[model samples]
Structure formats: C-alpha cells, structure tokens
Target chain A: MPRSIPDQSKFAPGLTLQLDADQLHAFFPLLQKGVAVPATVGCTLKCLLCDQFSIPADYVTDRITTIFMDNRPVDDLEHTIIQDGSRVTLSAAMPGLVGATMRRGGFYAALRQGISHVSGGAAAADQHGTVRIKLFNLLLAELGPLVLARGLILEPAELADLLKSIPDRPLDSSPGTSRVLLTVRFNE
Target chain B: MDKIARIDMGAAGGPKVTVGDLGEYAGLGGRAMTSLVVAAEVHPLAHPLGAENKLVISPGMLSGTTGSMTGRLSVGCKSPLTGTIKESNAGGQAAQVLARLGYAAVILEGKPEGDDLYKIVINKDGIQVIVDNSLKLMDNYPLVAKLRQEYGDKAAYMSIGSAGERKLLAASIACTDPELRPTRHCGRGGVGAVMGAKRVKAIILDDAGMKMRPPKDPDAYRDANRKFVEGLRKHPVTGEGLPAYGTNVLTNVLNEAGGYPTNNFKSGQFADSAKLSGETQAALEISRGGSATHGCHRGCVIQCSGIYNDKDGNYVTKQPEYETVWSHGGHCGISNLDTVAKLDYIDDNIGVDTIEMGVTIGVAMDAGLAEFGDDAAAIRLMEEVAKGTPLGRVLGSGAAITGKVFGVERVPVVKDQALPAYDPRAIQGIGVTYATTTQGADHTAGYAIATNILKVGGDVDPLKTEGQIELSRNLQIATAAIDSTGMCLFIAFAIMDQPETFQALLDMLGSFHGITMTGDDVVALGKKVLSAERDFNARAGFTKHHDRLPRFFYNEPIAPHNQTFLMKDEELDEVFNW
Candidate 1:
C-alpha cells in the first residue's frame, strides 16, 4: 500500500518538503487568482512568499494589487515567508482607501505603519503540515472552476474534518446542495 | 415644484403646521436640503436636544422618479452625540412616498411642551399632527405593527424606540422596509433623539392615490435609467457579489486582508471569523429556508440586503451587513451568527445604532463588565437597553460615554461616534475619512473602501499614507453630491468604474429637470453641500482638533501587522480645504 494515504510517516517528527512554486500553481490554478486551498498537500514546508509561486511578471507589476499571507496583508513580498498551514491570497487592484492601504509595497503603506506584517516567525524546520488558500471577488470567477474540477491536494484527515462541518442532510446524492463539491476519486 | 411643510411643535394651543415655498432652498434636495435648512436656521451652539435644534427630513432630488436606487432619505439636525452638524440617511419606502406626495422637505421645528407623544400622518391630501401618548415608549416593531393596522400595509413609517425615547446618544430612527419591518434605520449621531425631542412618535407616509413624479423628458429619462441599471447589473461588486452574498461578503475579504478589527480593535484577525463570515451566513440562511439575497427597498438593483431566518425558518432580521457582523461578531469576540442576528433585531427594534452599541459593549467587556466572546452577556446588555435600565441608559449613550463610564481607555471613536467595522490603522485612507468626516466616524461618508478593498473604480495602496488625503477629499465631495440625489451610494461602484454610467447619472438629472448638467455641476453641488455642513459644524464649536481619531489609535499598535494611525493632524486638516 502507498503508506495508507495520509501515511503516518509523512507527518513524522522530521519531514520537510521544498514545495515547488510551479508545481503548486500548476496543480491548483485557483491559487493564481487566490483561494484558501486547504492543507491536504502534505509535508511540513517552508518557502519565501515570493518564491512560493512563479506568477506572470505582469501579475507582480500591474495585475496583482494586493497579497495576503496567513490573514495578514504582506507589505514586503520578498521578506514575507509562507509557513506550513498558511493561507496565501492574491488579488487584482481593489477599490477604496483600505484597498490601497493593503496593497503590497504601495505608497500608503505608511498609514498602517504599526500593523504591517513583519517576518518574525519562520516556518518550523521539521514537522507535519497543511495549508489553505482563498480567492475572492473577481479572482473567484477568474480562477475557481479549474480548482474545483482538478481539485487541490488535501490530507485525508483535513478532508474528513471539512466534511464533518457540513450538515449531514445535504451530503447524500445531490452535489448541488454543497457550495464546494468534493469527489473521492481514489482510496489507498 | 415640491413644497416644504413645516411643523411647529412648540406652538401654543397644540401644534401648528404650515406649508410654504422652497424659496432659497428651491434647487436643493436630500442631504443638500436638510443640511442647508439646519445650517441656516438652527443656532449652532444651541443644545441639540433642546427646542432650538430643528430636525429636517427631506427626500433626495430623484426620490420619486423611476430611477433605480434613488430613494434615500436624509435626516439632519445638530447631533447630541457628536455636538456637530449631522445628516444621517437611510433607504426605505418613506422617501419615495414622501416625494410623490409633493414635498421637498418636512421640517420638524421646536419642541413639545409636555411629555405627550404625537403622530404625524401624510398622504395625497395633506399632513396631520395628532397627540397619541399611547404610542409612548413602544419599540419600533410593535409601534409600526400598530400603525400598519390603522394606516394599512402600503404606507411607510419612520419611528423611534426606547433608546430614542430615553434621549440616549446612540438612538437611531427606524424606517420600515418593503416587508413593513422596521429593519432599515437612519442609525447615526442620535438623529432619533432630535425627533424624540420633538415628541414625535412616528411619521406615516401614505402617498395613496399619488403618482410617480414624471420627468421633464420621459424618453430621455427612461434611456438614462436603462443605461444606469445596465451598468449596475454588469459590475461584479454591484451585480453578482452583492446580490449573491449581500454586503456581508466583505467579512471574508476584509478578514483575509487582515483588517477585520476583531476583539475591540486589539487585532485585525479573528480566529473564529469563518463562523460569522458572509459565506457561512448565506449558506445557513438558505438551508434554514430563508433567502440568501433580497432588497431592502423595491427599486434596489444591488439587493445587498436579505431576510435572515433562524434555524427554525422564522425571520430574525434582514441579512446583517458586514459592519453589523464585525461589530456584533468579531468586535466583541463573539462569532455565533445566530446571536449576532438576534442582537441586530434588538438594535433595530429598540432604535439604537448597532455600530455604537456593539462598540459600547466591547468597551464594557474591556472593563470586565462581561467577558469577551460571551454571547449571553451581550444579549443581556441589549435587553438592558430595551428595558431602559440605568446601566442600559449609560450603554445607550454610545461608545464614547460607555468608555468614560467603564474607565476603559482604548475607545475607538472620532467626534464621539463609534468607528465602523474597518480599523483606521489597517486602512489609512479610511483613517483620514474617519478623522475628518463632518458626520463623525462614518464609513459611508467617504467609503475609500471602494478603492482600497473592492478595486471597483481603481486601486490605492491601502497601507500607505500617500494619496490618502486626496482620495478622502474627492470621495467625500462625490459622496455628498450622491447623498443629495437620494440615490443609493452603492451606485458609486458602477459609476466610478464606468464613465458612461456617470454620464448617465448626469443625463438623468438633465432629463428630469429639462436642463443640461455637466461633471463640474455635480462637483459644485457636492462642494455646496459640504460647505453648508462644515459651516454648521464649525458654528457648533467643532475645531480642527475635533476632526481626528482617538489618541489611542496613534499610541496602541494593533497585533498581527502592528500598525498605528500614522496620518498627521495637518494632513487631515486639508481634507475639506477645497
């Protein structure tokens, strides 16, 4: 057996995976626009926020207006790190004063001078892990379908946990009742 | 062509009513009309709750027309809470009905000599002011319910509840929505207290046998309206996102941006945020046999409001907006959506500003009156307001007063009004707005959130101070003009992004009045409105210092990002210089 899906060894005391940025985005195109992909893509991982993905240069130059990692908006993309079980979001230019204030490396970053995220906590050197991504507004429509169809990887336990949160009555035959459709294609 | 109706409650031998020409106020409507009247007539230094402070209720310029999203009503008076000129607005049937009844503004002047509550009924015929002490101290829901029986379901109502009756600073005036439920409110700066001072229990607008106000050129008006609706329908924010999840959709987006203002502005993130998010709430609402999308008013195209039913499939309240969710949910460290919904119902029914009440409760929690994340304790505090207990009265005085009473120093307010959901430290452009808006700490006053978060019109770096002052100034001016038109402010999303849609608005105005109006004219109108309001606030003893965020916003750094309000006082002073 392929170490029983979740594979206890995969989450053992000392395991690290240098998650490739291209492989991450290729497997989950929804990550391009930004969506909280759950932590099913296993292994305790560490990667620089800028190195986690290879987006079009234009995305950095003009397309992406804001970037948020682990709920806090990333003001400095290069210095910021994406740790295990983190949520990374990407967005095009958003309107309003707050939108500008949250834009990465934008002119108004001084307004939120006290609250801009600092790169203090590094990713755990060796541990088991999971991460989530969430896309919003325009990005949702721009990149949602592919993620739903191809589906990002999730640890079996995390998948089961998410499933339990859904009300039991709607889990039967009609997938339409659920906002997110999860299909179990294979079992270890 | 609309007439002004003035009611003098202080008149000897009962109340006296007079109908007159608009005269100098002829061209103004909505916030423009109300702000002008209050600024020109009322003494700036007069006690806001005294007879000297006049209350002006007016419909926007396009209120009765067939234009979509153009039925906002402006309620203006010197605010007892902020001690500044205040023009609070809301959407309901009242504006449309009152406008069609041929009234430009209804001025409630003077104060009632005795303690008797009065009711004013308006229809196609005329206006009637009558004494009805029976309606005294009744909450908005039951009071409107009683009126529905007498006035029938078609009439719209504006009323106050125990909070207003008690003259609390946080009191809000409730306006009945399409379902005749008193859910929509003019909830800011204690305008309801001014109405209470007038001893007016409710204002019923029948408008039966009246027709919609016809435009000067019907064909042109129809064309402009069609284009306006088209722009609204195609915009992602207005059409799809708002309709699908309502304004609460910002819950997840703002949370993800790390500016959600959880636990009384201590941090920008909430651990249990997903529980109260728009996504979760919408799903739950649908599963519980309620709609995930609905409109508060008939002509609303955005449909950002909805009916939230409890698990048993009974209506609790209209879908709580994002601010209400953050205020009652994350601000107080409570994440139970059902609890937040119930709190919303209580706030609406008792006629209190939900934002003020939520922030006050958070301040109380900081004082150890109740533990953070304690839902039952929050409910008890709301019940206290409903019951008009001593503790409730202090709480109902709003967040600033609550902070004083409880000795909690970290109060988030500007000019005495509590800040809305967005933290100024996290979003600096809004910080500039909060510090400078004439109406105090109001989000909708400028709504830089459009550019900062939604990317509707354009993008601004939300975290930086660069371009923030200009952004706030331009938005404030545009917003003042929009408020005067009586159009829903949400239309800004489409109009700001699409120049043609903006032109369509000007065309609608031109077609309605049989005159051409340019972009300059719109800017001029906005400037005119702001000048009137600024003049009033100045006369009311508000100086440049009054236009600033709480000092704690500068000293205390919120967690996660650890930011403080960095906008200088001098930069904020420049917001209204134009």
Candidate 2:
C-alpha cells in the first residue's frame, strides 16, 4: 500500500479495494491529450477507465473490523486539496508512455484541451477536472446538442451507465469545433 | 382548535363530507388522513381533473398551536401527473390559520358552475363564499398582490395560476412562505388542478386567535422540539450545506459521484455541470443582490431554499434545484443556464411540476418538435403550450402524452410521471424508489440517511443493483413515518444522526395521547400508510409491471461509464417485501 492512501474499511466490512501507485501512474498518462506516448499505452484511447465494466480498484477500509482485528493498519484517510505551487512529480516511465499514445478524437477531446489549457492543470501531470462550471456549461450548451443532432441518440437513463464506463474527459481532434458545449450561446 | 368551526363555502352542492369520527387528534394527521380519504372518496379510475376528484387540505398536528417549524400543510388529491394518490406537503401559515378557525380537514369536492371566478375565506367565525369578480386575476404574481391588498398582509393565501386554471396535469398548488412570498409551493402531484376544479382562484385565511396546540405535557413537548431543532442545526447537511448551497449543490457532487443524469440520461456527468451548480448559484445570488439562503416557513433553522434574481435585477424565481437544472440542462442537451432559468421562470408562473415540464419538452424535442439543444426553439415550443396551441395542449398534458405523440421508446418514466434528475443506473436505490413509489418516480418518497457515516447508505456502485431494492424499501418506510408527522422532510437528516431527537418525536406523541408509545408503533403506522397507497394504485389498474424502470434502461448502455440498469425483475419485486 502507498503511504498516502488511508484504509477506511474499519466501519464498513467488505469495502476494501486498492490501486498501486505504479498502476495509478500507468493510468495517469491516458488522461493527458496531445502528449505522445509509447505504443504500450494502447490504441484508440480505450483504457479501462473508459470501459463499461471496470470499477476503480480503490478499496474503502471496513472501519469496524480494522480497529479490532488488524493493525499494520492503514492509517487515517488523509484528504488534501491540490493547490497551485505544490510540487508535483511523475515517475520516469510516464514521460515516454504518455508521449507515444495515439490521440482521442471527437468533440470531448477538443473541449478537454481547452479545459486543460485554461485551468493549467495539465502541466503538473494528471489534471482530471478543474473547477470551471461556467466554461463547461456554456460549451455543453453549444456542442452537446450538435453531437446529439449528429446522431448520439442517448436516453436520459443511459447516462449513469456511460459515466461508469468513461470516467475521464474525452480528447478533442477537430480544431475549429471549439469542442466544449458550454461556450455556445443561444442565438436570439 | 377550541372553536372547531366549519366553512360552508356559503354556496351549495359541492362534494362535501366529514371525517375525524375516530374522534381523536392523535389518530391521523394531515398527509395520512388525506391519502385515506382520497382512496375512500374518489373512484379508483376517476379522471383526476373531474369534479369527483376531491382536494383535501389538512394541518399537521401542531400547526395551529405554538411549536417550532409547525407551519406546515398538506394538499392531497388523485394526481393528474402520477394518476394515483398524492399528498404534497408545504410550510405556510395557511394550515395553522385554517386549523385555528376550527376545521381538522377541508375537502373541496365537485366543480363550481362558472366562468366567473370566486374566493374562499376562513376566519374565527366561519367560511364565506366571496365574490372575486373584481379581481379576475390571470397571473399568480399579480394575484398574490391583489390578495394581500384585499385581505390583510398577515393573511395566508393559497392560489393557482393559468396552468392550474387550464387543468394542466402537472399543475402545482402555490402556498405562501414565511416571507409572505408565494415561492414555496406544494410543487408536485397536480394538487393545483384539484383546487382549480372547485372554481376557487384562492383561499384567503384569517384566523385571529384560536390556538389548538397539542395538549401534550407542555414542558416535555417543548424540550423535545428544542432538541430536535438543535440537532438539525448541528448537522452539516441540514444546517450548513443545504442552506448555503440550496438543493442545487448536488449538481457538482452528484456529477462527481456518477449519479447526475445528463443528455436524457446518456451520460453520468455534464462537463459544464459546475456552471449551473449550487456554487455558481450562490455566487450569482451574492453578485445579484439576492439572498443565498431563505426560510420556507416560520422558525425554520434549516433554511435550504433561495431566491434567485435575473441580470436585470428582477426577481426571476427561486434558484431552482439541481433536479431542475439537470432535467432542463443535460436531459435535453441544453446547458445554457439562462435558457434553463427561463423554463424555471415559466414553470413557477405556470404553476406546474418542473420535472414533468422538462422531460415533456425533451420528449417533444425527441419527436422532432424541435432540434436537440435548440434552446430557443424549445422555449418557443413551451410558449406554444403556454398559449394553449394544439401541440402545446399535448405537451401541457404531461410526459405520457408527449411519449405517446413521439413514439420515443426510451421514455424515462414510471406510472406516467417522468423520472427526476438522479440517473437510477448509477444510484440504484433511488431507482427502486422511482419504480415502486405510488407517487410515480419520486425521489422524496424514500430518502433515509446513513446510520453513522457522514456519507449516506445506498451509495451502491452505480453499475450494480445488488442492494438497491433492500435499501429503497427501508427508506420508504422511514420516509412515510416522517411524512405522517407533517414535519419538514429535511428533518430526516437530524433524526438519522441523533437517536434522541428521533425518539423525542415518538415521545411527543406519547405525551399528547396520554399513553406510552414504542418505536414499533411508528413502524406499524408507516407500513399502514404504504399499504393504503398500494391499495389505491392497485385499484387504479396499476399492476406490479407498471412499477418498473423503463426497458431502455436495461437494453442500452450509457457512454463514458457504459453501465446498464442490471436489476432483475424478481429482485425489484423484493422492494415490497417489507
């Protein structure tokens, strides 16, 4: 277990799940777009995160049992917000693997590019989602409908299923599409 | 009330009957008795808008008396939206005022004969059928203003708008809040249509001084109420989080948890979801010179509602909930907050259920009434409905009509009512509630909190349905019991965290009745309420099959996560095992 991950399963039994830092680092490359990566990073941007059935392997420690039965024990779950000016470093392998992977295509991919560029979360390594509501809502208002009109006939109920399969933002390939849905304004 | 008077309406031959022959204040409160009376009075298959469909208003046990947060009321009828028994509760001085005037329940039956409008006024002496020809109000905003002018400012008023007047299936009953603002509505289940059928534009209340406080061991009840409020104020969910963010806070959180439904439930997350979320809403309120937190009723400690204004500094409406945001924004692929805000604006003025309106509009877009994300076009379509155009007639009728007109196979609904914001494929427990609830796909019907953890129970992996049924059943029972007390639903958070406060409610009952009560009795009453509702739905031709998630939920997989609704039929049946 990594030093940072806390075991929270003491109260909830059968809640343990985990991802080694090495595996986490392997996953980090898939989130960054335009960064070329080794062929080992896979083709078509179809990593486990975007797959339908894969759940995050992080386990919640059973708080009740952990207190009584075992004590090599994962310490407290230390939650900290990632702030600017904090030093961030990636493993030596991330640079090459991320740089070589094939890029993701379509609207989401382009939107993520703008999001990363604006939030500047991309520079440090894994910038999943920056807190940018207005930017996101406006772009979605514009692009999402166009995508749907182009024939992604998705029903409302299907969203939760989609979310489970694809955990990260899609990479944008179309240069002028603006990629994000929220930026578009309603034409008066 | 010591007076215990009755309103005759002074005019004749309306559907008038009486109850409370069981003859005790302790027997049944507002929400419970209303459900039973509706079941007993209206034919199971009667059209919801017909004269035969009765509307009942009953006060909580403590409303007319001195008690903290006791200014609550219930509006009950066979819902035009759900096509079943529905009791939507609200907090206003109306119920307290009405109760003090001496009536346990007010049942408005049959239609009044006229194009001419009227109003019903209740006071310490009796009921008066008043001539409202002078008012002839069309809009709710101006109608409340006229009502305040006629009756004093302190009077509690219950009125409906054009949507209710037209008998729209999704119409809501508008009741005044503590601020004397007509913002806090019994905002679901077509209660307004029921009131409108009686030809009553508004019911003006003026009960001067007839207090019928529960004759509990006074010290004990007071002690219990204090503890209850204190517990509510201490919890972050009820105390701080809700008041600060309002219900819209869930926009970002639910999205992060993979529970927020987007683009007609196609994706769990909306990238720009944060923009329309509670954070942005709170920020907007600050910038626009509006209050971020506002009280719904008198003496409410957990003030989780807000009044949001527009850019022009005009009062737009309450910062509509996260459910409203998700329903209009992501469901139809329209993320423009301003456009979404327009829908909230129309819904409040129109006096209809926002959930029903959004889903219906989305369905209209699905059927080629408008292009997806053509928010302007969508607005035009709704305006057509508002103007009573032919297509507007169908859309205004509700989700079922829209689904029928469009031939859309992926209708996200249960029992004719559209499902609310939460994507059940991710939050399976809420899905069970949507499927089984008599109110038809409602989230509030079953919302029990987690036992110890700050995080709630039923946080099942979105993709798995393993524990959804069991979790939903337990929650429904808890919720029904709470609703019977006429207490605010937000109080559930405090009760979940503190056993003492929860117990004190039961203790208050014991104090009032002069008999010892147990936790088991509360459990029994909850079961009874559910059984009564089940009986109503069954009689109304609602087979167990109707209590189901839409078929597309299983066949299609949502993108991004790619999860399907995997709960089996037999597993869903287990929801009624309790």
Best by DockQ: 1
> Candidate 1, residues B1-578: lDDT per residue as tens digits?
36999999999988899999989999789999999999999999999999899999999999988999988999999999999889999998889988999999999998978899999999888999999989989999999999999999999999999888889999999888999999989999999989998899899999889999999999999999999999989875677767877777676657776678888889887877767866667768887999878887779998888889988899899999888998989999999999999999999999999999999999999989999999999999989989999999999999999999888889999999999988877777688889899999998888432233223224555444546776787778778888899998878767766778888888999999899987767777878888988988887878999998988889988765677888888999988876
Computed on C-alphas against the true complex, the DockQ of each candidate is: 0.24, 0.03
Poorest stretch of ten by lDDT in candidate 1 chain B: B448-457
- Work out the TM-score per prediction: 0.86, 0.73
Which candidate should be chosen as best, given lDDT against the real structure? 1
lDDT tens digits, residue span A1-188, model 1: 01112223433232122222223222222333233332323221223222223234554555555767666667655456555567767655444445545667764455445555675644334333335656654455444443333334444444444444434323442322222324222111
lDDT of 2 by residue, B1-578 (tens): 33222232323654233333334333666677678778777888988877678787877656666555666787788888888898887776677777666566777776766666678877766677665766553657678888888787878888887778777777777777766666657777778877776677888888676556665587777776777777777765566667776777556445543556776676776766655776567767766877778777766777777777788777777777777887778778887777887888777666777888888887777778787788898789778767767787788877777888878776788888888887766545567678888788887787653222212233333223344555566667666766766677676656665777677666666765566766667666667778888898889888789888898888777644456676667877877775
- When only the first chain is scored, the TM-scores of the models are 0.51, 0.14
On a 0 to 1 DockQ scale, where is model 2? Answer: 0.03
Residue range with the least summed lDDT across 10 consecutive positions in model 2 chain B: B449-458
Question: Candidate 2: where is the Cα deviation over 4 Å?
Answer: A1-188, B1-26, B131-137, B212-214, B449-466, B512-517
Error of 1 at B530 (Å): 1.5
Per-residue error (Å), model 1, residue B357: 0.6
